[model samples]
Target: MSSSRTARWILAAVAAAGAYAPAWAAELPDRTPGLWETRALIDGRYRVVRRCFKQGERSAFIDAVGVGACSASAQKTIFGGWMMQADCRTPKALLSGKLLVSGDFGAELQGRVVTSVTPAAGGPVVKRTAMTFSSRRLGECATTPRG
Candidate 1:
């Protein structure tokens, strides 16, 4: 066979392999859960959006970015949004952190106003997180909404 024919066969084989990879890796979950958007501070430089799911008995926290990242801690509070206790609870969180949504989804940070966030979840999509925080913070500097 000519070299051209050999190359064509190799390309066809590669294409076939590529097509099946995703199908094989596809997850068949017992429950396909819709994630709730939670507000979280990321790296103290920007804000992030996160989601939580029930993975078996334990809750899972995920940073909703271009890529998915699992978070360690998620807490639910009185309001909406979330305060990622994973690493954001620490001081270094200012530099590197992600908003985890689990335990409590978008409940803690609903009213708390802070400087920065990570993973940067912005725009009209998560207006709830933004609206609640800005309304309380800018609306009144002194008597902030009680949690």
Candidate 2:
């Protein structure tokens, strides 16, 4: 094929991908991080939680300590990287300031909620939520645009 023809083919492929971009963007996940801190509402006031984690890392010894379960969403740049927002709540909701991750299987933005205003002893255990952003090299959250 001629060079011009090859270039046209590449451009066409890119355009096709852009059309369904939003759905794909929403499906992607965030990267993992070494340490993270965020604000929270406690007794009608706000506080922060800072944590340390590693990929494929879990502790059975601390099962009694309690760990939170959370969820997240992501936004994609024209390039391959992403910005993700994770929520770990009683009702569960997204938060401000998204964590960024690479195109390589976003595992950074994860969350959980383990506490609740209501106790399980009354009936069932209600849980509180917490957001965990396992991310790219701490500061790799920022990236350049593809366009």
Candidate 3:
């Protein structure tokens, strides 16, 4: 085989491997059941909030990225974390983004999501938004009895 033919075959094989890899998409472990304090930074502004997760609950950070009509394009494990890519459609815009998450779910977690949005009826303009967040488990949540 000529050098170019051999190179093309190699590239094809790599592409085929990637095509099937998403079938085993790696997932981040669920957050621990308890209260968590989450701090987020967006556009140089900071906000903190607390939330409680029940047993087998997904991380709030993960939920934030899945808002609106989204179809996950890819997921994989990387750098002691999981990375997810998706495209989403909302009433006003179409967005594409990636979320990167890391840290042990038992005690602390860190994540960042960056998305680019295009107006549904716009020309070639795109708006980009990003948020960086970190959460620490803050013991158990207080239980409220239902009357």
Candidate 4:
């Protein structure tokens, strides 16, 4: 994929990371189970995606982005949200990021995740990327029949 495309995907994944309730994994607020609309800004362009969260699916977003790909190290409550530090290893680079999440979370949420990517080959240069995103509850999710 093109570098721009890759950056878009990475931004989407980072945004998805904030959409779901990863309370068990990172102490994030328990997101209401429903359909959510997430809008992200990457490279001065905006992209939107919608996701449906079932009643019992807690880690769906994390899984969609690639399970275990990113790990949170430290997190603390902020005035209207939370701040966290995370690290991940991508195919070509290692990423270290600080994520700031805010808003009530029941209806609307917003945050920023800024990352510095270091080439895995031990390069002398590092690339930094910052993505901002917002998510809102769209409504209840459509139900599916049990197998």
- Report every candidate's CA lDDT: 0.24, 0.31, 0.57, 0.66
Clashing pairs in 4: none
Q: Model 1: per-residue lDDT, tens digit, 42-80? A: 223233333332332112211111112223333332233
Best by lDDT: 4
What digit string (tens of lDDT, one per residue) describes model 3 on residues 1-147? 233322222222111111112233345465678888777675566666677768865533333334335566888789888777766555566656667778877888777767666776765536566667787899999999999
- What digit string (tens of lDDT, one per residue) describes model 2 on residues 1-147? 233322222222111111112234355432253443333332343344343434532222123212342343434553455443433232222111233333343223222112222322343433333222222233323344999
Best by TM-score: 4
Worst 10 residues of 1 by lDDT: 128-137
| Total backbone clashes of candidate 2, pairs 3 or more residues apart or in separate chains | 27
TM-score of 3: 0.69
lDDT tens per residue, model 4, 38-135: 88886577778788756555444355446666676777788867887866666776667677888865678888877677776767536676778888
Task: Give model 4's TM-score versus the native structure.
Answer: 0.75
True-structure Cα RMSD, model 4: 3.4
| Candidate 1 Cα lDDT to native | 0.24
TM-score of model number 2: 0.28
lDDT of model 2 at residue 48? 42
Candidate 4: regions farther than 4 A off = 17-26, 56-61, 64-66, 144-147
For each candidate in turn, give its C-alpha RMSD to the true structure in angstroms: 21.3, 19.8, 14.1, 3.4
Poorly placed runs, candidate 2 (over 4 Å): 1-31, 57-62, 65-147
TM-score of each: 0.19, 0.28, 0.69, 0.75
